[model samples]
Target: MELTDNDRSIATFTMLAHAVVHWFELAIPIFLVVWLDAFEVSVAVVGVVVALGYVPFGLGALPAGLLADRYGPKRLVVLCLAGTSVSFVTLAVATSIYAVAASLLCWGILASIYHPAGLALISTGVEDRGTVFAWHGIAGNVGIALGPFATATLLLVLEWRLVAVALAVPGLLATLYGLRLQFDPTAGLEGDSESDTNADGDTGSRAGSAFVSNSRTLFASSFLLVFAVVTFVGLYYRGVLTYLPELLGGLPAMEGIEPPAGLEELSLGDYVYVGLLVAGMAGQYAAGKLTSRVAVARGLVAVFVGLAILAVAFVPVSAMGLAAIVLYCVVLGFSLFAIEPFYQEAVAVYTPPESRGLSYGYTYLGMFGLGSLSIAFGGVLLDRATVGVFFGTLSILALIGAGLSVRLLTGPSPTDTEVPEPTAADD
Candidate 1:
């Protein structure tokens, strides 16, 4: 399909905004390692403190979506980038753990706006939603990989504070890009009718009733099943990524490896972690390409089944040899991110144009908000059970998601369905 200049511009800005938001979000984990030495706090304490910021990151998405629907998405995109830049700068000057925690809290609130706003824009503003979403997912993975990579690399030359200040530059540039960017409101919608509806209505009673009505409509729709599937995916995502490095460290292949003599003490596992994330870029691209060819439900089932197998295989493969472990990382990373575009497409398929922002908002709330709890849950499992048990649990979650995807397949394909409009019938 031939993309117009407007399509290209919206896709570029949307992808950049996604990358900048994730870069800031993922950078915190790298800093958590730094804080261990800089502040002399226990790991458990740091985890809880960081959660203070993370919880808001998940919780704020719904409101951010609501706001994007009220205002234009462009405004929220600019705000997310600019605010994140400021938050990173604030993190740069922090002298205490409490200050760091507070800065992160600020960052969380700011960064939370992007997923809902960016996805909504792409889902509704880009004509080639599949290709754009695929590229968007790739950009996100780049940010996910770069955030920690940049932080870790910069720490070798400068203080962690300086590193944070350096990290803010991209957000500042993205903010500027967002200022000049414009999107066609009707680009991805089925028609102009819904887009022309008065998104902002009267206050007081009208607002209250609209909110209640919207809530009820959402519950009554297939969006609930989509949310459930996304939630299961989130739990798997969080549990696996949060502990991946530590788990890789326990691999036999990494047992005797050493960092290069001139560098700081990087481990084999760290390199493996980076490699896996890099591999996910291919997965994102492939998934995006497949969106036009494969059915969403079928693709989700295949990806999740692969995830389940990988989850079970990770332990045994790590014990085999370095070659085997590397292969495992590639496959695991690919499956981990490959499901994103399909599920994102599913949201647009299941929801109407008017509620698309809120749909993405609640989708991310499942992906990030409810998913955040998996960190603690994974921790508890690690402490109480065998590593085998942990992988088993992840497999179960992926299978559950796959089961839900099968259920979705039994209904009308998202691609085949006409975009619905909000009306009395919906209420």
Candidate 2:
């Protein structure tokens, strides 16, 4: 099906908004490090603050989902964009560590408003859900790619506080653009003739008949295994995303690279670390195309296996170690992001369309919320263990996660699709 002009416009706008949000996500880690050093605080404390941003995304997913379902996703997206803009700006001005903490807490909560609502909007707006979602993921990955670069650039030219100010501008512009969006309620919810349900998982019927069936379908065993694998995937992905820079600094390769000007001398590579993230963007886009040609499960399994091999390639003492680090970063980017579409497909397979929103909310909670807790734990582990132990531990978990993907292929359920699964999967 061809997209109408309005559909194209909405999708373009949605992608733009999503890219802006990812910028803030990429900025926080590097910023946290700078803040810690500037304030003479411990790395452990900075880790806590960095991890804190993730809390609201998970905790607020349900509410964000509910708001999308009830009031329409458009408003929620606007609110989140505005909230992020305000929060990022406040972060620029924040002097006290407590103030930065509070701002991030708010940022995390507001950032939560975007994903479910933005995604739901995209799903509703486009006829081709898989490709649209893939593109959406690409946009986010691109934002993530640019964010650290932007931060690094600012750090090069100005004080860290000024860098924060520079970062806030894109978010503010995105928020303003978001507020002007025109939403067509009828067009977006076209296929959703099912009864409305809130985010809390409460059941209600439309006129006591049309919407109130409460028998939630239990997935076949394969779905459970798929879910479990995804959980570990989430943990590994979030953990690595949280710690890559510190890992670099801890390594021998970066011991010689000069720090960004005015920044304290550090062992971490001084180049645009954003390049590492951009490589992942390339991986995600490639994976998105590849998943459709092969089975999603098979594609994910290949990526995960690659992750394990990349982990084994790690050696804390040689130049080969640096090559392994770059390789694994790209591999993680490929596998971590490439698996998302398959996960979305699994949700569609396991749950009824009417209940899909709630199912997705729970799935994200597992992936982002509970997964975030796992990330926090990894930070704790990093505090106690060496960088080698950290990657080694994550590699083991990823291999285990890949093994679980086999379960997804074991049952009849995975091969069956009630909705038209993507034909020409990458197209």
Candidate 3:
């Protein structure tokens, strides 16, 4: 599809916004080892403290979405960028683990606003949303790859604190750029005002009823089914990614390679990890392209089925020789990230334009908020069960997600139909 100037602008800024937001979010994991030594704390303790930050990242989305509807997406997005920068600067001066926790907490709150705000913007603002969502997902994967890669590289010559402060620079620049960008608040809601009018042709008197109707419409079975599918996807995502490195390191193929000193030590298992995540960029693009041709539900089913197969294969493949291990990482990486755009697209497709922000808000709450529970649950499984058991559970989750996708496929499609504009109060 050909792109217009507005489409290009929205995609460019939103993609950059996605990259920076994820870069800040993922960079924390690289600091885990550093924090362990510096703070002299148990791994479990570090885990709990980090959860403080992550929990809010998920939970805050609902309110952020409400705010986006009331105040506008651009304002919340700019706040997200600037607030993330400040959180990093706070981290740079941390003197204790508590301080680190506090900074991450601050970071999580700010980071929470981006998904609901940014995705809402794209879904409502862009004409070619499927392509835009694909590029947006790729940009997020770039941030995911760059965060750890940059953190690991910078730690070679600088302390973790300094590296964090340095990382904040891009967010500040993005904020400045956002301040100048112009967006039409009603870009995607052109027909909404007329649709919202009552039989008598008055909108103001029925404003309250319109809100109730929209709320009911949002929680209807179709949207709810999609929500359930996305929640399962979130569970699978968090469960697998939380311990991927250790799982890979424990493989027989990775044995006997002497751990390097300093920054090189940080590079351990990273090549495979980064390679898989970087390959996901292609996955995102491919999924985007496929959705333009296929039904969203069919695309979701294919991706989740692929994910389930890969999750089951991961354990056995790592036990094989080096060639098999590389193959495992490549396919696993592609399958892992490829599903994101489909689910994102599903949310936009299933919900009305006026409530698009709210739909994405709840969507991410499941993805991040409820999804954060996987970290703790995964840790418990790892301690009490075998690697096969842990991965098996993830495989089961993926199957559940696939089952949900099948259900969605059989339901009525909600494909970007026009809806009434929200009343002033609804906004």
Candidate 4:
């Protein structure tokens, strides 16, 4: 399906924003290797430092969603990109762990804007929402995979500091480019007549009342179960990526590989880590296609179960041979991202279109904010325990997510069906 000019404009802007967000995000793990040595910190210490950034990145989404409503998705998207650029530049210059932590926190706060703003914009603006969602997820996974690969590649020639500054360039360019593009943010929803947004015109008290009301209404429905699924998936997504390269480094396949001349901070694990996420791009596309065709809850259960089985096999697979390990990485990456579209659509199925911004805001709030613990927790495990324990925990976590999906599938029909649509007078 071809997107019209307006849809293309909006979709392209959101896609760019999504990609840049993950670009800075996943790159941190690659830098974790450098930080571990340069700052002389333990895995737990460094993990906490990075979580300082990610926690806000997730936690701030609710406010970011509100701000996106008061202002606009386009404006917030620009701030997210530009602020993230500055934050990375800050990270590049940091001389202490404290400075690094502060930079990450700043980045998180700004990057937090992307999900609520971007997804809301898409649900409202794009004519072909499902296709755009697929493309958006694929673009994000590209940034996800490329971040580490780009950082690792640049580090081969330049210092990590230079690489950081270099990474900031594309985002800045993207922000500027985003500024000049314009489209009606609600083009797709123009005919719907019923929605929970007065957002741009919302007064302080009215907005708060709406927030409380919406929260009450959403939670009273199946959205709560949807939220639970993401919280668990969030753990799998953040925990695994946070320490994956280091975990891969311990494998026999990653042994005996040396960095190029004068490059002591590089690791062979980074490339394999990137390859796994690159595989996720395919998963993202596939899941996007599946979201509209399948029972979202049922499909998600299968994906999470795949994640559980893969997590259990991760350590054992590395012991088999390089070919087996490579195959495992592909399947694992595929399963990891495959859950995204299914759950994203699940958010829609369980909530109203009016509170789109707030719904997605809370969605990310659970996924990223609460999910940041996985990073800290994984760091602690890697620092204090064995690889088997870490992967075993992730397997258990994925099973928990699978259970949540099962509940969602068998629970009452979508709660969105129960809500009465608000008219203009309700606004």
What TM-score goes with each of the models? 0.91, 0.76, 0.88, 0.84
- C-alpha displacement of 153 in model 3, angstroms? 2.8
**Range of the 10 consecutive residues with the lowest summed lDDT in candidate 2:** 206-215
Question: For candidate 4, lDDT tens digit of each residue in 1-427?
Answer: 5689988998789888899998999888788889999999999999899888877877899988766655667778889999999999998779998899899989988999999888878877777776678789989988877887788889888998999999999899999999888787767766553654543322121366556776777788888888889999999998988788777877888788897775566577766766787788888888878876788899989999899898888887888977787788888888898888888878766766666677788889989878878988898898899888999999999999999999989989864345533423346
User: What value does the lDDT take at residue 9 in candidate 2?
Assistant: 65
As for TM-score, the candidate ahead, 1 or 3, is: 1
- For model 4, state the Cα shift of residue 417 in Å: 4.2
Candidate 2, residues 1-427, lDDT tens digits: the string is 4566667766777788789888888888778768977878888887777767867877787566655654666777788888887888887678888788888999999998787677666555555555656676789888877887688768877998778878888878877776766645234445553434333222232222222221123233244565576677778778876777666566666665566676564445433245566666666666655544667677667777777766655554335556666655555566567777666655544454443444455566667877776666787777898666777888898788778776666655643523212123112
Regions of candidate 4 where Cα sits further than 4 Å from its true position: 26-51, 88-104, 149-165, 190-193, 196-207, 257-267, 379-386, 415-427
Clashing pairs in 3: 192-421
Candidate 3 global lDDT: 0.80
lDDT of each: 0.81, 0.65, 0.80, 0.82
Instruction: List model 1 lDDT by residue over 351-419, tens digit each.
Output: 766666777889999999898778888999999998888999999999999999888889754544344
Candidate 1 wrongly placed segments (more than 4 Å): 33-45, 191-193, 197-207, 412-427
Model 2 TM-score on a 0 to 1 scale: 0.76
Residue 111, model 4: Cα distance from true site in angstroms: 1.4
Better of 3 and 4 by TM-score: 3
lDDT of 2 at 119: 67
